[model samples]
Target: MNAPTSPHILAAAQRPIPDAFMAALTARFGSQCVTSLAVREQHGRDEGSLTAPPPAAVVYAESTQDVQDAVALCHQHEVPVIAYGAGSSLEGHLLAVQGGISIDVNRMNQVLSIDTEDLTITVQPGITRKQLNEAIKDTGFFFPIDPGADASIGGMASTRASGTNAVRYGTMRENVLALEVVTASGQVIRTGNRAKKSAAGYDLTRLMVGSEGTLGIFTEISLRIYPLPEAVSAAICSFSTIEAAVRTVIETIQLGIPIARVELIDVNAVRMVNAYSKLDLREEPMLLMEFHGSPTGVKEQAEMVQDLASEHGGNAFEWAERPEDRTRLFTARHNAYFAAVASVPACRCITTDTCVPISRLADALLQCVTEADASGIPYFLVGHVGDGNFHFGYLIDPDNDTQRAQAEQLNHQLVQRAIALGGTCTGEHGIGVHKQGFLLEEAGEGAVAMMRAIKQALDPKNILNPGKIFQIG
Candidate 1:
């Protein structure tokens, strides 16, 4: 297989769009609406280490009406419309493959309403997870679909993102209750109600949750919130081997421990995190954990988990009770990707996520480590292991064809092993452009066909986030 070239290189150097098309876009959207050079380049890229393709124009949408009008215009012109959120997607979700319009929703960042009694908050599509949390901090409540980065709430819902808290609270699929979406035809429709469980009709709200913005543009969302935990305790436990650490997690979950967060970091990840965050953590495979509840309840849970870890050969456990200490610990954990990237000079990080059955986690992780070692690919491993989901970050020199090919081979083998263990190719990140082949292999022809039907039924014109989830003409 050939190395993946930079999308920008392909678009600008190999497949540049005609000037007449740019003139038509400007005529339709006006001068203030269209951005060409630097702005277009920036909007087309994302947190994913892959090279970005500049959208022909980047439009700053101000309201739902703006999105509707923009999509309507694109539909009429038979051009592709790619929705842009915080640019934090790891799977090339925002790259403008057809290169028409990058509809940026940043200006629409507004908390529409806060239903305190109902424990739900309604917000515009552009509102980020961190901004929402900060706005609702004083209310003693929070929306917890955290994807590490302060990603837009819409993007989180679109990608079905889950992070540290997913072990306890669940992912965006459980958090998002309703959505006001603009369809491909520029028609706005509400998906569900604020009421918890509805059996009235088809569950459209969920169908859109991990659609990767291929179905419609989410204009507003009503999300579930939870009261802040009464007590919170965080700790770190080191182990000699990654397998031992993962086995401890599996055992803890099997024993019905109500742990709020249990993340596994391989020895390599621990080293990179220490250097990146300037902390002197022991460079060994470790489990970073947290518990939430009454002080007594948290203590009991921690003790129970400590016993399980001991059985798995876990070393001394270090607990952090102070708020500042807990904050610093989790902050470093969240920055694991950046730390991994920083460890390698002039190399881009390619991350692959896979989830397996709890009993198979140890085997899966060990296999991943062995593959990386055998290939001599510099990599780091970290995961929400409590959910049996883990990620591998491979730092590769994309310019080197042999190195890039080897990395892809390793990634493919990892995905194959995960699927063989009855897990998914992507645990949280949706099947955007990068993992479409894996998705087809895992889900099979029938499932892929059903997904295509849904896409066609909702977006007949193929204008809503074209060339994502699965490739289209």
Candidate 2:
């Protein structure tokens, strides 16, 4: 393996900014408000391999009033305002496309209220999923929108993120009860309440859940919580082929198994995990499984899934019940992307996620793998298969034109296949410039026009995270 090269370092350094912008920002916000260049650059991009121009300035906001004032100032100056969180998004969602003020929300991390009776928690948007969960640990309840990253609740809500547990707990769309947002006009408004359901006027809460921060900046969030199960068990099951593993997942879901986490890892990913994590495991297609319920319920559920796996020629099921063991298992799975990148130094990681119907998952995955092999691109496969969503991480040398072309070809073919099979180009990761064209292809021109109209109606000034989900005309 070769040493990693900073491909976009020079370009990022050369990115220009307005001379008076920093002075104005400092005048408005004290010296402590602005972060150093290292911090600004760190908050500018996400885990995705795409390079983006860093923001002209980053503001450390501490409260909703601060966010509102900052946004109002940007709106007045005709500058873009990008909300910054933990920078864990996978589609370059945090990139300062228009390069203006980045409202860093990490300072606002605080759990304001936890209503045990209502099973809801009100927290500042910058609070991460892990932090929230730890805070609520002793309450016998937990938030379930786990996006594999310790991502901020605000970022997760913006992206409408879901993860391995989505099959059972749903995504941020269902888990977020309400949101306190600063609109494009810089007015602060509450979207919803603690009520379980409502027939409100416009359902603005749901609309903003997946808006990718293009419409408003979330200051605080009210999230639905679930009672921590009486028992939790995780397992790993191997299969002879990727087809068999996917087929088993489809069958299990069709059977309505209450699986908490059912992820699919192709043989290639298993190989990478072995090399990166130093675990001597079978180099075959595998499924990382989990169940959350009462002891009896989890036992019965595991039995049912085991029988289904057996029908698909799956190998012996190895279960992990201890918390440490469970953590080790998921830690490896969560680090799968980093492991794949580690396989080839000096390579940029380009990952694409697509969701298909459960029945067509095997066919879709087979086509993706076939195209990847034919193009001779080094890639690894892993996904939340229970929900029919998967990701392909392609390792490419960006300087090599042939490698770049091959990766693009594979990405195009994979997305086309997904759309043709009545699936979406992206399931969790929002269309943050990387998939704008594919989104247009997936949702026809009329749909795109309607989306643009909504954007205009909500954000007439176009100051909130401009040039994100859609191209402004």
Candidate 3:
């Protein structure tokens, strides 16, 4: 099957940015408003293959009021407003598809409040996961939702991002407790609250968690934090084949091992990582795992997983107990995407995120692997396999149309198979411009219509991140 094209792929019309809007933006934000081509260029694109023109202006929002003012100006002028955080999104999330302005929130980085007694922390949207952990390092707690990149908390919330820890800790959808959002018209509204559970009203927090900036801009976020695990141990086990590694993950999850973090890195990705990260690791299909709990509990869990690996023809486990050692191993795993991209100079990656049920993971992954190998497209594979989510980074030279089409076709096939196997086209990366067609394929017409209705109600003008997720009106 040919790759599906997003309806607006080549047809997104740029809306006019009136001089009056610029005047208002300049008057309100002053130096914070930047119209330089360089700055606008930086804000206009994310770490994705899709490209679009830069926004007309970029506003550095230092406070919630600043975001409100900028968004209000855009709303009044009928201009689109795309929220900008760390700009680490893998999909085309930051593209100014229809042209307007970008609200950069990196200046808003701050920890607003931390309630250790309640196991919660309220933070400005700009704070990155690593920074949050550093601020609360002395408090015996850490935020668990890590999407690898030092993505801003707001970006993570917008994408409902989950990472290596998701198998045990859950995604942003579960951990985010409350939000202070600026509506499409610049009205500030709070969704949910610090309370753990509430039955009072619609779950607006849930609605906005993965809205991908289409509904509103997140100004503040409160997240559930977890106490540091009593014992943390990490290990890597190589396997003879990709199926063996994936099968081990499926069986481990089925056996209910409570594995904290289990990741799969195929041979090509491992080779790239070794070159990029300058670490000597087993260049084979490998499972990198971590165990968390009390000392005895961690030991028992590790022993059980080790036995399972051996049963599946996995090599002897290589353990990392020193904190620094464990950090080194995971840091490489997190950098796998970049490594793969850099391996081929001047090549852009079309990454795929497909998640299937644990029982179907082997079938889904093995089939995709076979197809990718047959297609001869250079690719790297890595996954948070414990939760049945994986990524394939297809590296293709930008000038080669045939290579790009091949990568997209591979991505399409994987997403369709994932959907058929009771999975999502996207596990963590939100549906940005690149995945709009996949969203339609997976959600069907009726469900997408409801989503469009919600977007219409929340953003009547379609001024908030217009032309993303789906075409509005």
Which model scores highest in lDDT? 3
- Candidate 2 local lDDT, 1-473, one digit each (tens): 11113233224222234556556677878964565788778878888877776777788899999899888877767778899899888777788766776899998999999999989999999999899999999999999887788989999999999998999999999999999999998999999999999998989999999999998999989999999999999999999988888888898899888999999988889899988888766889999999999999999999999998899999968999999999988888888988898999888888888999988898899978888877778899999999989999999996786676667667778888999999998999999867887888899989989988999988887778877878776
Query: For residues 1-473, could you state the per-residue lDDT of candidate 1 as single tens digits?
Result: 23333232234221344566567656756754767588888888787756656777887888898888887777666677888889999887888776677899998999989988999999998989899999999999988666688899989999999988999999999999999998888889999999988998999999999999999999999999999999999999999988888889998999899999999988899999999999999899999999999999999999999998999899969999999999999999999999988898888877888999988998888877888999888999999999999999889886776777677778888989999999999999888777888888999989999999999888887777777888654
Clash total of candidate 2: 0
Estimated TM-score for each candidate: 0.95, 0.95, 0.98
lDDT of each: 0.86, 0.86, 0.93
Error of 1 at 368 (Å): 1.4
Q: Candidate 3 residues 329-351, lDDT tens each?
A: 99999999999988999999899
lDDT sort, best first: 3, 2, 1
Clashing pairs in 1: none
